[model samples]
Target: LYAGVGSLSNIGDQGMEAEEGRAAIWRLDLETEQAGIFASGLRNAVGMAWEPSTGTLWTVVNERDGLGDETPPDYLTSVREGGFYGWPYCYWGQTVDDRVPQDPALVARAITPDYALGGHTASLGLCWMPAGTLPGFPDGMVIGQHGSWNRSTLSGYRVIFVPFAGGKPSGPPRDILSGFLSDDEKTAYGRPVGVAIGADGKSLLVADDVGDIIWRVTAA
Candidate 1:
């Protein structure tokens, strides 16, 4: 079984940077019950999936903050074995975060992510949807952007779709569930979190934290 660790507040501010054994994905051997790190340097890898075409492991990462509202974009990428993603020292593949202590050696080895999901989107939920799973949607990843309180805007309060072809993202992201924020932006009607396929195998299930609702998405 593969599981993720977590992220840090303020992007490792106050000497909380990614250290020797933090912010990593661990692969556990169920037979023997042994677990070890599979990848490191991911700030907050919230959602994970398996691409059906290649069976490769992929994830959505919530990156560091304080570089303005849009410095580093949260990303989606394939997880390579023993890969380092540059959490504290740099972001978006070696851009160099001045806030964190410098580390040229490790930054040089950081892996560039495959796709960007915009800054502070807080994209959390991730589920694999095959072609035609939803009436008009194609094969892709379904993500829930669990809204946060720090941003000055509605950066992430809805669900989105990133189309995939072969084994990678093929097109622009499309809105799956939106209208979460109010017209005045004072109240949020819903905040999406976890995502999954319904038991019937034809519909999508989304968890709305703010409204406490599990939305069932399907063809009308």
Candidate 2:
């Protein structure tokens, strides 16, 4: 079993010391009942999914805030065994985070994410989209971007689709559902968080945390 660990602090760079191991992904052995660190340095690795064609483990990460609306981009990437993702010390492949105490060693090992989901989007939910799951859509990952709180203009209040090829993202993201925010962008109609394929094998399920509703999407 794989479990996610979010960072203790959003922007202060606290509680991420080597010994704390607070920001990481952990694996649990069901038989032996032993748990061990699988990957390290993910600020908030929220949604985990396995690629249908290649079987690679992937996740949508929620990066640290307070870098304005677009300093560092949140991302989606494959999880490597014992890999490091560079949380407090660095971000987005060796771009040093000046706010934190520097760790040259871990910074050298930071693996850049595969796709940038834009900064301050608060992307959280991810689910693998299999081939033929939707008639017009290709195999990909369906992501629920829960939207931003600290940004001035706001972003990511809807669900998006990122196409995948050979178990990796290949194209720009497409909007599966949008218009969650009001015309003036001051009010939120809903905030989508969790996403999954329905039991019927064709529909998609979306969980709106703000509206407290489950939305179903079917081919028209």
Candidate 3:
């Protein structure tokens, strides 16, 4: 049940603390409202999912702006509670522009993400397929890279799959869905924002925000 935020408050500075962005994993045994920080420093996370076999939580994070077209890469990562990802200071486990004073010690202490989905990919919507379902999709983490608008050339207008083994993601991403954009890439018919497994058990459901359509992918 961890959640990510661009900002907790609109004040711009007061709500930027990393601890302010987390939420409880679950509500258990209490009538009172109870929540706590799970992880922090995510600019915006539109996608989250748990690996059904191992119960590991992963998230797709949309990084911050103001960096040039390629400075910071949007990422998909395993979200561990109490983890701190650098925001407004560092990125991708590297110290960024010196304008922001990042403690060298703190930067070294932060956990770098698992995969860099290319700069400005604007990753979103993640899900894991159950084992023994999809024959080739064994690891089962599918992510929607929501493409980019800030870059001169747009990128990431497809859905990708990350295979996992023993609860850990391994190997390069596989393009599960693509070709939603025009041949020239100037226009796109779909901008996939979310992904989920279909009720039929063999299909994958994708939410395309740009076309306002939902696409169903099944074995051919």
All candidates' TM-scores? 0.95, 0.96, 0.85
lDDT of 2 by residue, 92-207 (tens): 98999888878899899999999999988988899987878887899999999999888878899999999998778999999999999997889999999999999999999999
Q: Give the winner by TM-score.
A: 2
Residue range 73-158, candidate 3, lDDT tens digits: 88888877777776655778766646564567656656788877877887888988775555567756888878988887788899
Candidate 3, residue 160: the lDDT equals 89
Off by over 4 Å in 1: 14-18
Give me the displacement of residue 117 in model 3, in angstroms. Answer: 0.9
- Candidate No. with top lDDT: 2
Q: lDDT by residue for model 1 over 1-220, one digit each (tens)?
A: 9898876555566565335556778899999998899998898888999998899999999887777677798888899999999887788898888877787999999999999988888988898998888888889999999875666665888899999997999999999889998877899999999999999989999999889999999988
For candidate 1, the 10 contiguous residues with the lowest summed lDDT are 10-19
lDDT of 2: 0.89
Per-prediction RMSD in angstroms? 1.5, 1.4, 3.3
- lDDT for position 159 in model 1: 92
- The segments of candidate 3 whose C-alpha lies over 4 angstroms from its true place after superposition are 8-32, 103-105
